[model samples]
Target: MAKYDYDLFVIGAGSGGVRAARLAAMAGAKVLVAEEHRVGGTCVIRGCVPKKFMVYASEYAHHFKMAEGYGWTVGESSFDWPRFIAEKDKEIARLSGIYVRNLQNAGAELVHGRATLLDAHTVEVAGRGRVTADKILVAPGARPWMPVELPGIEHAITSNEAFHLEELPKRIVIAGGGYIALEFAGIFNGLGVETTLVHRGPNVLRGFDDDIRAHIAEEMDKRGIKVILGAQHAAIEKTDTGLVSRFTDGHHCESDVVMFALGRAPYVDGLGLEAAGVELDEDGAVRVDDYSRTNVENIWAVGDVTNRINLTPVAIREGHAFADTEFNNKPTTFDHDMVASAVFSQPPIGSVGLSEAEARHRLGKVDVYLARFRPMKYALTGYSERCLVKLVVEAATEKVVGCHVVGPDAPEIIQLAAVAMKMGVTKTQWDSTCAVHPTLAEELVTLREKYVPQGLGQAA
Candidate 1:
């Protein structure tokens, strides 16, 4: 064989790349992974890990208020934004070190610099020597997208800035109708920001089940988050006090800062895929097959770079499948149907399998069971917030085709269903099981009235 510097050359040290690099090395392939920034990638450093920490911090404010109801006194419910940010930063730094250690222990040499493809078999580092490998993997991940049409757009920040804000702004406006915008708005609002969420669509989280979206909208409004629907941003001008954002509907809302949860784009700007003979989707995402192999031979791509589902776990699965099929030679294929995901908005949302609407469209008949009521803790706080659980089953097969929930602890509750749905669980199995009494999750089995319908929204 002709001489090569490494057996496998991996680009982007994000979730997918790290996993691929470590596993390829463990499989006895000489591996070298190049990362421009940190080894842990966006999820560990900037995205999910840090974002969830902020969510937890924002949640404590409500927990402190609820403490009064549980007969425990929460004196001086004050928060230090700087302290929280520092603590979160510490957690990220600690986790990032672990990722680097794992890569080294697995025998993958981790290089720190920007890597550009010189050819299909050769890559050049910004200031280092050329690396020639038998196979290459790209897992560049994704970054947030912002709009420029709005005048004075410099005031807006994405989720990256949302986490590291030095001092929490007293007033803020969040744009976009997606989960990121919704979740951040909830975190900021819960932390006592005079917050408004503006969405161009009729509602936020539009792709989720309609019932959950509607109930969540009601809950968001109840929580004092002003929702401006069917509106687009025209401009954001800085003023002496804060910022004023004009809406396309000829209205204006003023806030100290503006954020766009608009959307995310694949991080493929400098990855020389064109020269490597790799194909990409119109949105700049590297298109891969079931095995995560790009169009070019011996080259593969995975994770948010592919724009397939754009969730952390999905990226992890893609990486594992790519390593198994490409390096390990086990040749595994993944079936991505019936994926489950959770959105951590104020009244959180969790969904799995076909939506109620989707089930009716294809199967035409569905049995939907819905449970809605005040959770036990809400009675103590006098909050009057309600919880909902919806189940959609195939009428003919009695298989649970979909599961949806919108409420407090919805993410925790729906995770159980997510696993069960992945196993192709049936409604009979769900009902035949005994219920755990008095807990919110037990509502999944205690739903009253077996719903049967074929109407537009009767599924829910």
Candidate 2:
């Protein structure tokens, strides 16, 4: 007789957990996946997939203007929030169903309930009886965080609630300067909402390349987003007209909506990690080794809960590696280095490897190549928006250590650039590549001149 009810008990049907469960079940292990909410996790349901759709829907406003600049007689147009919401909801449901069917097809059992640890090898699902497993994998993911103590914070919404707003706001004030805040600022502004972005820091995208940061900020201003720097939300007050967001500096902005995109926190509360003796880091993220193994031998975790690179693809890679190591008799560990990422802001951003600051700090001496130019698509238009492409090369090895792009199709461009950087492509090798004439991406290969900032040393 089997010692446990299942070979593997997976908690949360998010990307990582689902991937691990499917792989493990396919490997002939009995796997059960328990999720409290929908089958698809945040990325499919809220974070990435739906957010990208919003980005697409919001972009048409500018496209119409560009069409006119190209001599196309575009007629009147308007966006219907209810219709878009209904369509978006329908597609989300379909995607969630696909995740469900995939798990079933892979021979993994699904339980629609929250799963909490009873012990190292036991999980108790809410309203369901306890279940035993030889191993447990946690991939509960993360949730948007806001300061609970802030006055009238209840009037504010996070990204989670932004997608479900009944009607588009006339104006919005979004706090924070991270990718989420910037992306939403673009979405709202592109959709014709008077948008204001407030950040406590002097510049946005704190960890990104400084040049990229300055360029994006300027672009945001061009797009009509009021960028407020060196300010924090001191309080939120609800009035008859709208919500008032008062800044620490005593200034204020009144808007129909106030969103706190401060950041996300790992969804570890009430999961009974203490019961299983699973260790968590100082920030409440599950502490795991390279193999995604928790301190408790039989319990493992991946995805945002572990907080290692927080991107969905990274979570999936970690999950697959864990399953392969545990079930397929093959030891695998995902290489977290050189992972490419994208911000779906207006014009968008794609980046891989280290930033210029990181390269300079770590390697001491680095060569920087940068180019900024108007894309051909906007040549006829009055738009002054320009695309940015930059490369950071280690002076010693001449290897391209970083690639950053901002503007149209930046994400797609960076993805391909990541491949070369991953293969240790050097600066000379990158330049030797033939340019696809009359293209934005071609600028990457054509950048021969080393950009030197005035009054700065040679390393920049």
Candidate 3:
């Protein structure tokens, strides 16, 4: 007889949890998934998918301007923010339905309720009593964080509320220097909102390659997005005219909205993790080992809840690996190394592997190959937009350790570069490859000079 009602029970039907549930069930284990919210989790419901749609909507203004440079007569155009939001919502609903149906099709039962761990091998669905499971997987993911220390802080919106704003703000002030902050800054600015990006750091994108950070900041400024650095908003106050943001540096700005994108914190609240003896890290993230196993033998976690690489793809991979290891006896572990990612800011960013700073610290010495130029499309249009491609190579092994690109289609270019870096592609191999005629990506192979010690010079 089966020891429990379910062989596996998963809490939080986000990408990771859903994937794990489907895989385990397909492998013949009886799986049940409980979700308090929608099935698609953050990436599908409120994050990457919707954010990327907004990014596409935001770029039309630039495209129209570039059209003029191309000698094409463009008529006056206006954006219907409401229509875009409605369309975005429709798409999200469609994707969420697919996630739910996939699990059902795989023979995983879906429960619509919040779930809490009752013990090591049991879960209590809110208002639905309890169910026993031999194993449980937690993948609740994370929630946007905003500092509440300041007065009237509640008046500010996080990314969650940004999608539902009644009207596009004429002026918007954004806080933080991370991916979310940069992406929204670009989104609002491109959509013709007067945008001011305020960060408490010396520059934006703190952990990215230094050149990429500086170049993006410069590009954002050229596009007329005011980049405020090294200071934070002291307080947000509602006034007769929109909102007023007082800065710690004694300066202030008034805007229609104040959006904070500081970062995300793992969502483990009310999970009754303590009752199950599931441990958590200091940052409130569920603690797990290399294999996503929690302290309890029957408990495991993956994705943002574990706080390991917070990308959606990483979560999906971890979820799949868990199912393979636990159900298929394959003992698979997601290879976290060399995972590629993209930031959908105005110019966009595609990066993979270690940053130059990391390589310098880890490998002692590294050769940096870099190219920065105006793309060919801009030549006739007189667009001053620039593209940057940089490669970081380990000096001792000549293996490419990192690839970074910014500007047009940076994400697309960097994705291909990630494959090469993952396969340990060397500088010589890149050099041997012929250039794609007159293309921005061709610079990836054609860059021959190492970065000069001072400023932006090239090796002779």
Better of 1 and 2 by lDDT: 2
The TM-score obtained by model 3 is 0.98
On a 0 to 100 scale, what is the lDDT of residue 166 in model 2?
98
lDDT of 1 at 185: 87
The lDDT for every candidate, in the order shown, is 0.86, 0.94, 0.91
lDDT of 2: 0.94
Please rank every candidate by lDDT, starting with the best. Answer: 2, 3, 1
TM-score of 2: 0.99
On TM-score, the leading prediction is 2
How high is each candidate's TM-score? 0.96, 0.99, 0.98
lDDT of 1 by residue, 1-460 (tens): 6578888899889888988888889999999999998878888988888888878888988888888998988888688989888888998999999999999999999889998887898999876778898899998788889787668888888888888887999999999888888888889999999999999898778778877888888889988899999998998888899899999999999998899989999988878888898899989899888889888887888889998888877877788888888778889866778888788888788888887778888998788898789888788898978888899899899899899988878888877887888888888898877888878888898775875444645434
- Model 1 earns a TM-score of 0.96
Candidate 3 lDDT for residue 89: 96
Candidate 3, 370-391: lDDT as tens digits: 9889988788887788988998
lDDT of 2 by residue, 1-460 (tens): 9999999999999899999999999999999999999988999998999999999999999999999988999998999999999999999999999999999999999999988887898889987789999999999999999999999999999999999999999999999999999999999999999999999999999989998999999999999999999999999999999999999988999999999999999999999999989999999999999999999999999999998899999999999999999999999999999999999988899999999889989998888899988989999998999889999999999999999999999999999999999999999999999999888999999999888867786535
- What's model 1's lDDT at 5? 88
